[model samples]
Target: MSALERLNGTRLTGTEEAFALHRRINRTATDYPRDSSVPALFAASAARHPDALAVVQDGRAYTYARLDRLSNGLARRMLAQGFTPGSTAGVCLTRSPELIVALLAVLKCGGVYVPFDAGWPDERLRGLLARADCRWVLTDRPEQLARRLGACRVLPVDEGVEECETAPGVEVGGDALAYVNFTSGSTGSPKGVAIRHRSIARLVLGARFARLEADSRLLQLAPVTFDAATFEIWGALLNGGTCVLYPEGLVRLSRLGRVIDDHRVTVVFLTTALFNAVIDEAPGALDGTETVLMGGELHSIPHVAAALRRYGPGRLVHVYGPTEATTFATYHRIDRLIPDSGLLPIGTPIQNTRLYVTDGTTLCEPGRTGEICLAGDGLSPGYLGMPELTAERFVDREIDGVGERLYRTGDHGTLLPDGSLVFQGREDDQVKINGFRIELGEVAHHLDRHPAVRRSHVTVSTERGERSLVAFVVADPSVTSASLRHHLRTLLPAYLVPARIHLCEALPLTATGKVDGRALLAAHDTHTPPPAAPAAQPVATRD
Candidate 1:
């Protein structure tokens, strides 16, 4: 029998045993200040470097002392208004220095901040805030949003609030809920992942993956709602670095390059899709950036090689983790060209983090494919208001006679003998488009709600190295793909909206009577041409 087959049945050799141990748990026992909250850490940094640049945007800059006083004023105001520890507040504002102030203020007041993208539809934002049990919303357009969300009180942070610049007296612990990040769910509802202050500290403080120091200038390009902001924002503030906010709205590649050049940005994190675009369109954008980290989807080998060739090795990093793991868990620095496998290793776990590859009950041996599981200080407590699901996903498993709780990432990967992990793809219908996590079931659930539609299936289609959502629907004869697309755009976010909707008489099925997604795509490829527009109509047939 092979070494892998005998791994579970008998004792292994020393090298095999070492590989087994490595596959079961790859971790670094790094210590961090576990008793302090995120706000407390920021406060400490402010005290140490009072005059250091803390945040900047379009020629506007705030020193550490100034930002601290601003947040202190807001926090004092919030406390006087009955906001207390454990209170949930929604922050809906455009990307600016004010948004950072609001986030820090909420944490200072010991409230959980639920970030809402201002670009999101009002209806969608209202539903999410209600689901999160938010009693107040801090926004730039408070009056307008307050009218729509009548149930929650709204406070304006953009125009600035006049209050005392004294810090609040409240003391928050490390285990306190810091923020709630919502991700796409299969049940047609977005689930909020509740992360704690300690989790954030574990990710940013003493992070070995990227360079973060007082002299570091990190670019804040990600949306506040995305968990990546946790790294970009706190990774700077908590480290006495400067967070240069990118201008709001669509990220133009030319403008992005200019911003990085002007700010002398030392660290940057980009989604795989955007990174690929930068490499293809503007390779010079990263010329000045000291460290460029990219992930959120499987990377292209050619793009990786191109970036390495331009930036040289040791500067470009490939990171992997889910929102549930606080931002990043494993990071691989590409010091050389990728091997013939063309698959980039996700690398090993970061400091104070643990990673495992397992097949439900037992840990997988090296070279065996299994689910990627994560544990350690970076793991979030659980999903907000999803006890059952929290229990299902986060479970206690005995590893090497030690009971530990691990988040079972549905992503499939294989553990290498050297303890690095290589991405193989996900085991579920979720897909990451432009770095946004999307659930195919959630899209289909909303599509099936359309009155004219009988049934629908949503799948991702890749053409020319780009991934887009495609919906196949069996609908009324009078219904056009345009109307269906419009209907979906109203309910879902822009990214969740399918790029192409194909109207059909029936959906293709497998012999076992399930929706044959492969058959549908195969037939569509045979019958339909490349989609030039946002919608398509094809005469689909059952297999």
Candidate 2:
């Protein structure tokens, strides 16, 4: 009989017994502050270390006291403009000291911060703002874009605000919404994930994955809009450490190496794609850093081995998590790389987090593949204003007589006997291209909308471990791939646009009349032109 059976009068089968054992093996119970906000935590850090360096960018360093004062002054100005607690503010700014200040100021004013990539197309950015129901936008550059947002107030933080030097007295709770992160949605829009202050607090404060100590200098290299920024920014600020911001524009390898050395940076995080590029191009870029984390897509084994050989296994850590689960949920510190180790495990749960491999009903036995389910303090409340989707993805379930809410990640993986997880693949059409989550369905939806195109199907093609989007479209004879590419560029970001578009008389379909993805790839592989010489692609820029 299983533990569940022992607790009640129900009989248990062999599978049920295995499920009970698997739960015991995977569950990690840890304590974290359940009632703390980001501002409250940052204030506590500032009060303790007033003279410590808080942020560094563009040859300027801001101390804890100075940063506190700067954000406080801006927060008061926002409050004067009627920005209230629980209200959302759109932040469209490049990665800079001003961007960090604007984010902190919004939290200080008790408003939810919604970040947008400043480089995104105007139409794409506007659509995100409308979806989040934004009424105010804070920007450091291109005030024209902010002004174009009708009925939305614009605040430019770089222009200097009133120097009140006093923090706002607004009270915010742990459960209060903090920020909204937009991810690729299958319905041709983006899904804004409404995260709470507690969720972020759980990620940075007392995290075991990375060394986030007062002496730790974290390199803020990821874009402000990326979820990795949550770990980079707050991991330093809330921990009495210093955040060293990389300059704007593409991330050149030589510049990154210089930044790490000059700032004495101790911690850094890179997407899998960027990490691979760094290893292949500039293997010594991260040699001075103590901890280097890589994630956001399936990591390449060769790159991992190369990194371990250069930096040693102790300094490299592999992390995994979705936007809904704050920044990172699990971290696998590479102790040593065994030859022919097919793939590295994502490792165990981080502080105050739980990971479960389930087959939609009960936990799977060790070594069995199932959907990766996450639960705990790191989990977000749900999608913003999307209760139906929230219900479908984030569900409540009972195990061992305890009810808990779990976020079904839709990522398939298998739990090893030692409790680490090995990622299999996604269960849906969603793919992570260069650390950006994208839905192939979303791409197809936009492609089919072209007036000259009748129907379309989008698929990902992986060559030499690098993945790019490929589209097959049934369109007019006169419509060329270049024209379709131009059309997508206007509607979507450069990353979302297919690298290659093929014109077809009709898309291959299955017996059920659905687009046959495997068949399309097969046909493309059979008649595809010879590969051209690979060109150097930008590694650091999201585009």
Candidate 3:
């Protein structure tokens, strides 16, 4: 039996059942035979394709030679300024070629790059920088950030634009710290996830999920501060592919369609919500792309069913992972139509990764739901500067014969009959309405099945001391709340049906483009409840 088969608890046997099982739970881990540092590997790519196009932004292009020289100059300057190994530096800049240069330069100088969003408030930025203890900050506009970051050295990327000697090489180990990214915490204070060079090298170098190559042209669609950008930028740079960066604001479907076609982008990644919007508004937006990787929320596969059926050029892949898992832990390729259930499984673990669905003590059996846990080289070191919080989320567990560290994803999922995983909602998303438990994801799944309904978001709220469920839906202008409630009644129980429904032209989105449930709940609170239709009247209840 192969090591992979042993890892997955499959025994080798001369039988068709074992053959089918081997094909069912199979993923090939990529082997890294060269530099583990992302920057060093990118430099090697530049050596091979110096004159190739490396990045294109706003009608301007940058070649691999230019990018290499610019980042090398900046890294030399940073090294002269005492930014050395084990030092953390903040990168605060707008989305452009300079942002890419700044990030690569930080990595090249052996400094941890803590990327800051230019659109964030000054207070939040200040707090995050302080928490990270960044030694210096790199940006295009030092004047703008100087006041907010008192005493921290603010270095401008434009300085020393001419090529200088490359920074002296440092012996960087795989375990050396690389970058720190802050997650949007539920407690209002973001937690910084500290990752290492090994984790990043495993994710970027020859990753199969991305399908990036020397000739691949990948569009950088996510914000620079988001973790998805890590895959977009390095996946291209490490493989000698071209990184096509989009403009600064949210990209609409029309603009996305134009950009992909104009640039002949071979690969791109989008949030699940954005992917659904494109399928609903412009089904042919990704007609020419070779691959599309999307995740971050429950996928609306029914909307994408037609594209798969037509055998379009693009291969739609659903990638699932949390911030702690280095952006991609599991992936599922949608090559066929989804079953009638309108649900897609969050497939097996990626290269060098192992997953466990546990009920906090024992492993879950097939078709049983449990908390999703992940362990592998891609796991982050821990939450930066927050040991207690880190210990709570990243814990140790005994799996198979050895004890390994795993990150509790706080996501509920189940193993399918064929060894795939089906995502249930977040642990907190399981709500109790009038003493009846309901999975919000299941309710949304049924609601999306309606022909006129494009998307649905459900949230529980209390008004006048009476708690009930409120559903916000994106549907045709003429679609009524009564029709939705009646449609849902046929699929869900009476208690599971939302007590109130609101139709909107488009669902509101968070900064990261996920459905904003809190915003919808607040919007529903101010409006008076609508009268129920005669055929969809609610059962009598006591408050």
Please provide, for model 3 over 303-346, each residue's C-alpha lDDT reduced to its tens digit, 9 standing for 90 to 100.
56855765453498878887788888888887775568877888
Tens-digit lDDT string for candidate 2 (145-188)? 65567667888878365555678999898999889998889988
Per-model lDDT: 0.84, 0.83, 0.74
lDDT by residue (458-526, candidate 1, tens digit) is: 998877677778889999899998898778777777777877788888998889998998878777753
Ordering by TM-score:
1, 2, 3
Residue 407, candidate 2: C-alpha displacement in angstroms: 0.5
- Candidate that beats the other on TM-score, 1 or 3, i.e. the better one: 1
For TM-score, candidate 2 versus 3, the one ahead is 2
Q: How close is candidate 1 to the true structure, as a TM-score?
A: 0.92
Candidate 1 residue spans exceeding 4 A from truth:
1-20, 23-25, 525-543
